[model samples]
Target: MTAARLGPQERDAALRAMADTELDVLVVGGGIVGAGVALDAVARGLSVGLVEARDFASGTSSRSSKLIHGGLRYLEHLDFPLVREALTERGLLLSRIAPHLVRPVPFLFPLRSHWERPYIGAGVALYDALALSGTRTRGLPGHRHLSRRAALRIFPALRRDALVGAVQYWDAQVDDSRYVVMVLRTAATYGAHIASRTQAVGFLREGEHVTGARVVDLETGREFAVRAKQVVNAAGVWTDEIQEMVGGRGQIHVRASKGVHLVVPRDRIHASSGLILRTEKSVLFVIPWGRHWILGTTDTAWDLDKVHPAASRTDIDYVLNRVNAVLKTPLTRDDVEGVYAGLRPLLAGESEETSRLSREHTVAHPVPGLVLIAGGKYTTYRVMAKDAVDAVAHGLGGGVPPSVTDRLPLVGADGYFALWNQRRILARRTGLHVSRIQHLLRRYGSLIHEVLGLIAEQPDLKQPLTGADDYLRAEVVYAVRYEGARHLDDVLSRRTHIAIETWDRGLAAAEEAAQLMAGPLGWDDAQIAREVEYYRARIEAERAAQEQDSDQEADAVQHGAPDIVPQATTVRV
Candidate 1:
């Protein structure tokens, strides 16, 4: 039913089930870790229900560097164990978990002097060795070294005087938000109730133990008394806030660290292989992403607004300054096509700065019937999830089954590779380009057939989104009908790349996509107009913020940006 899509109707029904009956686990966030926890709990034969204050992975989980690898930077820190663990997870995601989405990407590290080559090459060799030793490593090649002339052959953008040689290594990348939605949908396929825009206000306490939660439906302002035996707080940066809801202090602190990134078209930089340069503060990655190369990522402590971490002027300049140092042709603000900022939920101890904090995660039973899991990197969300569910299983009262999700396939895993091979036939039937079919298959896997059917029923749906020409109208229609895209921003910004890809930044196409979605989602004219205005104002504010150079200035400009009606109006959790 369309009710499965976390809209007004579905949220009410799911919350009723949670309130009227006991649940095995109730997850309080829809980020990757929260979705993973729900999937894990359900796979273990437990009844599960999940709710989110925003859309799935709307926070830190979605705004990642989008790499799934044993971190090369961690090797320099000498944290072999953490690197090994992350590498194992990367292997699992690429080899078995989501092979269609996560694929290998090669990165080149240029050496400026004669002595630098071996030093850098040794580290690259160690990275490859560690991945090979990990249980999850597969479908990736080993690291290789290149002479100065050979390196120029592959990446002519490197200045002749700037580098002497280079080393190349393998890693995996993904569409972070897309993967989070897939996890939420897979949990739904397993009969775990799911809803978004449902805010967890406070913990329902039976003495010292949490029984469920009092959640407010953001759309209708109706409160639900959800009843679950165990509630997992996987709220990422909002970990401490969720912890306070249960009236408990944390054993470990979670500090919010902001990271910024810039996206520029591929033609702006002439390079065959991607580049990874070492910045003074942290590592910088220029990874290839479709028609563009994603850059930046400044690791600085941020105590600003958690909801929307605006990219300060300094952050953008810092990235451009560092990357342009090694490039033959320097980059300027005009060269940048898009910019984004995301917070990192870092596990802080007695560290001087957030950058010094550990990426390791911890699951704590802050109180009976309440569990809080936070502070981990995106690449290892599944492992973090398995640990969180393992902790919750002990409180379920019965003998709980072990997690079997490692062997389980997600929503479209059954015959995805075979279906991907048949995209040519799909292209013929839908009268779409083979490139369009390939894009659908990679993003939706076996679910590609469902989207194709929408086009078949309505031939007009075959047309691409106006400004975001990369997406088809079928996607915009299906996002509301099936993927729980409630507002226009959700469809353009999260469900598709229109917000970041185009020069006008989705302003030109907002109304058309919203009009297409309103019918399927039962939205009125006012709602559609509100959605379009919010998106346009937000785009203007983001652009204004990008023009300013300081955090204070950028925050002030972005403050004027259109703000959404947060799901939880109280904003405590």
Candidate 2:
């Protein structure tokens, strides 16, 4: 009924409302799928309460390859339906859903030999066709065959002899973390009660029927009960843990597959378009970010820490070696600006290799009260959410409305095109550079006015964050004021992506951000200092962990930085 701005006051009010009411659906986990589930349930006229232990998208959702793409490589295994579904979702996101956040990106898939050319070409053609068949297909160009010379013109950084030819195909990319936040915000706008930094301790059961859950406010040491008719567990990698909380082994098992990515300056790669190369284990992507390039993804089984999946020296070397195999000028550790590792929650199967495991999601009611949804890629999060909510509806034993999320645009999706067209006028009116206005438009879409309003209120906020010029100081304030960023890491890591974009990993801007956040969060000078110190220590710990050779060693080093949320309250069950 009212606009849902996820500020501190709004979060507190939501948490109070959640504890007091008997919701129709209580969605656990604040990752993309969980956020989607909350939105779907709320949109269907259900009273919904969504809770997260950490910041929204604090886990794998934020740490992904940031692509909303159909897995073209899946065609090799004849997973046509999965690929098609993902492509259709990608089309929807690009055109109808979050058009401002999701945009088309081109990738050059290099062909190693003459025979490989036709094989890869046919697969790519099918990928393009699948996208076009989608009802909401946008204006992305189809795949095209490019000779070695022609491909070189687009990607001169490629080694001349690395490919016989290349197939340029279309996909889409997003600020994965921001998209999740937007989804949660949209759900809140539709009357969903949402709270982050709220950990679910255990399920509240009335003799095997899940009626609700006991949750703790990690920010404070307060515990409360949220009652719901049905509880949906969309905890991505933590699916198994939530199942255990329900006192069962559960019907499904989720395996953690760690994938690491590297960030380098855009100039270091010299590519007009993104590059996708085949690897021994899986495919490697060198995605194009605005000022930097995202080079990633090493697929390997991880049994260590799920919270902080550290990127070890070996992991970094593996990505570098894979990308270096194709680059004319090799990229070493020095060229790397940042590194992040995330675990993919795969549905365990007969295959030993994690990459070979199924990305298709499985939904099951493990117990009378709990519904578990696990194992899907980022591209099809909405579908997974819809399926999970449908299960909840069945349990409720009523004519619950069908999911309308397919037609529902996120908060900023509407009026994005018109806003973009008037970017020049907006820049002039705001007394900001056109480039800065464009940057804000891309990140916030129609919400740019809210950010500009902050700058208007505080003229000093127009200046960029100290040492992190890419972001304005007003954006940091905004993280706390509107985006529910309670801590420095929440702003640095998720709300703005300053952590991965900067070489210092957001250390240089940590203090300034903490100061900006202090006023809104009501932090005293002492609290501000503590937050800054904690952030600095986190950066230091991450740097030390990256030098380790193995996951165990990296995890050990990373844990040296004490968690801001007290361990006693993080995961009680």
Candidate 3:
């Protein structure tokens, strides 16, 4: 069956279809796991419909450490199974599934003492050994112990007092937001009807069971009664809220912990390999991101604003002071170009500290028609998706085929490996630099042809974005056309790398991006200008908040600007 892509006009048609019939699964959220469940369920010959209140990956999925590791720290907690499962998925991602997106990254774990050398080395050794046991991991290398001399060869920026030696371990990195977008697209390709900016308000109940849901289209003030046999709630932070919607108290407690990261020029930390420093409470990473190095991530408890977690001066100072302990050239507040904060939906447990909460995700049948999933790391999102869909299968009320999503490849996965060999030719054909082509390949994988097609049609689209020059103008159009981008920020921030890549943090490129999306989304001159100004205000508020010393102060400063008008905030465009 050819899958449906719900264009703007088709929104009414799509909602009508939803109201007129029954679906096997109605996924409430549109994050990584919900998308995965929709894809998995549809591929198994079930009818699937997924809706997101915001753009795809607009939440925690978009803001991540960008690593797809097997959770090396989880081993310290003796969660060997969790680590192994993550490694298995990591291998699958690097080798077969989304190979274009996930790639190997070596991390240097500095050993401060001589005893630390053997202790950490043994842990990393076990980590790699576990990967070797997996099917798709043989292509990657094993762990290597680095002498103090050998370690300095790779990272000369390390302070002499920082380490006695280092242990190098292999992991993977990804564009978390792009990956989720890909997940949504792939699910759509498998015959799932997905519309972003569509909110599920209340349940459409039939006697004791929730036969469907009452939803409001955020773009147009239209109401919908989307009918389905099963509704899967993959809303990360709002799982509890969704539970309350169905008159059920949440079975599992999910506490939100804020993790903040800062982006600085790569030269700030002169290191060939990524740094994974052990903090007193949690681990801090100085991961290499394109032309910049992204760092910081305090695992402190945050109960304030979950939607916009602001990075205060204290948070940034803590990360800088901790990571700078090992840097030969220390980083100051001025070195920071961009800072972002995300709330982690940690599975609530007995541990008083947020850092101690389990990274493991769980699924529960909150009601006969509703299934809830939350609290997992980005790397293991596939497992969480699979598990959520599996729970949905029980509520389908028929003999349904088993989930074969593990064997199923994402839409762009098949030809991505082949695209790698012919990237130079692709660059030559498109009149783009090999570096630019490589960037698109990593982001879009085999779907680079789709992005390239946009450039080919409008030759001027090949030009790079003015302020956020690393991204091409065609990417902006593609975000609106294919990736379901609804607003200016959606194009500049999540769909492309422009947000964190630029020094101004996408403020300069916002207008151009909005203009590109306007044709597809149908925005007028006044609306486009409003979008640009709003994004500038958001960036300004965040910058002001980052200057504050404490979370409460930061939250006060950040939230002072005003509420962001998400399309779902009202119903009209």
lDDT of each residue in 446-515, candidate 2, tens digit only: 9888899999999999998997898999999988888889899999999998899998999889888999
TM-scores of all models?
A: 0.96, 0.98, 0.96
Instruction: Give per-residue CA lDDT, model 3, range 414-524, as digits (tens).
Output: 788778889899888878999999999988888888889887789999998889888889988888777778877788778886777778889888888888888888899
| Steric clash pairs (candidate 2) | none
Q: Which stretches of candidate 3 lie over 4 Å from their true place?
A: 1-13, 136-139, 562-573
Candidate 1 lDDT tens digits, 236-282: 99888787775546665789998998889999889888889888777
Best by lDDT: 2
lDDT of 3: 0.82
* Per-model CA lDDT versus the true structure: 0.83, 0.91, 0.82
Clashing pairs in 3: none
